[model samples]
Target: MARNRYSFLVKLPTAIALIAAADQLFLGTAIGSWIGALALGWILALLLSRPALRRRPSLVALAVAAGFTGVLAHAPSLLGWVLFWSALSIAALMPRIGRFDDAWRWGLRLLAHAMTGPLAPLLDGIRLFRARPRRGRPSSSGLAALLVLPLAMTGLFLALFASANPLIARGLTQVSLPSSFSVIFWALVLLVVWPSLRPTRWATRIVARMPSADIELPGLPQATLLLSLILFNAVFALQNGLDLAFLWSGAALPEGVTLADYAHRGAYPLIATALLAGLFVLVALKPGSASAANPAIRRLVVLWVAQNLLLVASSILRTLDYVEAYSLTGFRIAALAWMGLVAIGLVLICWRMLAGRSAAWLINANALMAALALGAASVVDLDASAAAWNVRHAREVGGRGVELDLCYLSWTGPSSLLSLIELERRPLPPRFRDRVRYVRAEVLETLVRRQADWRSWTWRNQRRLDTARRLLGANPPAPAATWPGTHRECDGWIRDDPAPEPAPSVTSESDPVANAVATTTPPLTGTPSR
Candidate 1:
């Protein structure tokens, strides 16, 4: 695989080079500007090399990159950081090499390429400079000899002089390196050196040279594949049937089982099961395997995938029902999204098996889908969405869920203000209503104060703050503590009195459980960050 040297002229590296320069130079003036500065740099690089981009990515690909960058720029959360780098990676490569055809292999190749990308050019520059002839410049061999003896003698004399004249030495050594100069020097060096780390075939060749065990395992024996499929299908059938009966049909659960608890228990684990099933399919049903060629085995595999899809759907409904019973949350929302993705992946797997598509094709297709979803999410504020859903579906809003957890809303930060304001309009007990007003007012005031500071400005916060002010007006909000309780039931909803104490229990004197309970200290409590 002799790759072209001119590949360095592609837009991907150009975009990267520009980003490396900008991030190195302009990132630290305002710490908050880091994501925005980097995002702007990426978008600029893309736009700058638009004319030169040889293989224009599909609009979907571009959207994925944009969404990944947009959300990261807006939120700056941990997820955002991961997506930001991943987006940069896919974008930087896609336009030059085109879509990756081998999923597992290409992924390894891309990783190594990124590590080596920046280092290769620096070494090349050193080599090129070393080989260049200086026609008229002095050899420096004589210069080095002339300086060696004198430099050592000067250092010796300076050391003796410094010891003799302490004040003079202190004055001479007082001039130290400036902190700002150190920052600029490193940034400048990176900016100058980054353009040299051009992408090469080194990673690709190395990955190709690596051994594979594809031929070693005779793929799960056909008899084993069939038996495994039958057993898996039966097990999945039982779970899916139970879900359809008890959950979807609204039948009562066994004593001690809440629907929310049941849903929570199965949601993530079922997703894992589906993922494992997909993996099994990829490995056991290699493209032209005897099992894949058997129509009966293919049918069984298809049936199993269908069962997995049903399980995924049940998991989704279970999550939604749980959210309705409790309240919406970021984790629950993400879990739902992930479950949906797994469901889609299962469908893709079935298609791959039926249509004779390679695992690579399946991978590329899923990657494209993931990229798009992320990009679309980036355009909206997910926290605000969660806050609004939770507030609207809350018991205060005639939903069968818990009433607005004011403390929880506070943990949601200012994103819950509008929802809190809406809840305030509802006819709540005077105490609950007052708490809502108090909390929203407090959050808005905090936002206004923070926004007033030059250092704390962010587009998302600024936009939300402006909306918060417009909705709540300029009056300063009252302190949340003014509502009475130290603890809160919701972000804005507080209790006037402490929680009711548990009833005294009558237990056997010899009961070990009772003894343990008596000795055990209660665990600590506080609201989680939303």
Candidate 2:
């Protein structure tokens, strides 16, 4: 049997040279920048040539050379490091290379063939220039177009920005703009003046010396549960939008405020519920035919359970005013209820996992349960919050407060916070509760701000507003504020006067460890810092 050898020299070396030249000419000679650029280029080349590299040693050599050049040319400082490591690695691989059989050699050849594309053109150019007369005129059009493209694109982007947004116009005008014609002209000149370099002949000669091989592996099931969950969530969102559109048509609610506002605010609970429900369905369906005895199945089940439990705990904490804590104005109570349902789902899943029977069926059941729980929780939170917040804000700010309140609701946009807000409306949808009581300090502050800014806002309803102002003033919002723009503006108006700071770092002798440990022997690391 004959062997094929692939040439990697031209492609690899040229790529490295091009990258090095580009970095030196444009980006400057910082060692770190050059090294980073070279590494990036090498990774790209490897990714691009992966299919071919698996088969041919010559191609691998070309790739390695290209990578090395890229590093050495761009980052000369790294040359020593690269050389040291390369020598060591080559020595380590020498034994393996020597022992490789005909099959492995064939595999290397296949890889070299795969990597030919990136190298072929450059090699062809090299050959062409080597034979051509130095003074002969060459076509410059292609080179000119390549150079002009980036500049043209950048100019168009700037033009569009200036036309669309007046705010950035001054900034745009201040920056130096490249001349498109000049760029194109320079590119053309380079194309005509530069020598042609070809790597194809070399590549062909090298590929001819390489060998070939065949390999196979058993089939494994690809998980589709994540995709299914995404699809389910999208559908739920669309449905929620339609429901809000219908509900807003009624005259009794605040004008222009739709159910979507509630949906956005309550997003956390909504997603949590949907995920839980999806898990239940997945557990129930047990889509793959793979047996429970499979280690993969066991691992997946464990992961699914753990993820659900974490999600459940987080959702519960959020509802109870721990994480993502907001005022309990709207569907906060409904969020709590949804969390309870999720808790129940978690319990059911744990039961199944412990029972250690019908693992597939139980897993599918868990998925279905998770999906339902998440879906119900999200919908409920959205409805309850929107209704309660809308009505409360409206009444607090007097009748004239409706429009601005509606605008505020709109400004919140299609986010989780809005969804939770909508969850508390009455004539409670079947299998859904209407009222919830728990409210966090943050949620209260938000409502207070809305009420204070209401179009019809007056000093008469200043009780809660006053209270919120005092609380916020005492806390003096952390330097890192979350909601900027309007929220921040609102906070400024509502927060009370700043308080004096307490002394720092004083430790009392009455502290538990201090009192007990001091009475005993000395501590392991020495006395605590004052």
The regions of model 1 sitting more than 4 angstroms off are: 1-34, 42-81, 90-103, 114-176, 180-204, 208-217, 254-261, 476-530
Question: How high is the CA lDDT of each candidate model?
Answer: 0.67, 0.42
Q: How well is each residue in 127-184 modelled by candidate 2, as lDDT tens digits?
A: 4434432345433344455668899999899889989998789887778865785455
Q: After superposing candidate 2, which stretches have Cα over 4 Å from the reference?
A: 1-289, 322-326, 350-530
Backbone N/Cα/C clashes per model = 13, 105
Q: Please give the lDDT score at residue 322 for candidate 1.
A: 74
Question: What's the lDDT of the predicted structure labeled candidate 1?
Answer: 0.67
Cα RMSDs, all models: 11.6, 24.4
Residue 439 accuracy (lDDT) in model 1: 74
Estimate the overall C-alpha local distance difference test score of candidate 2: 0.42
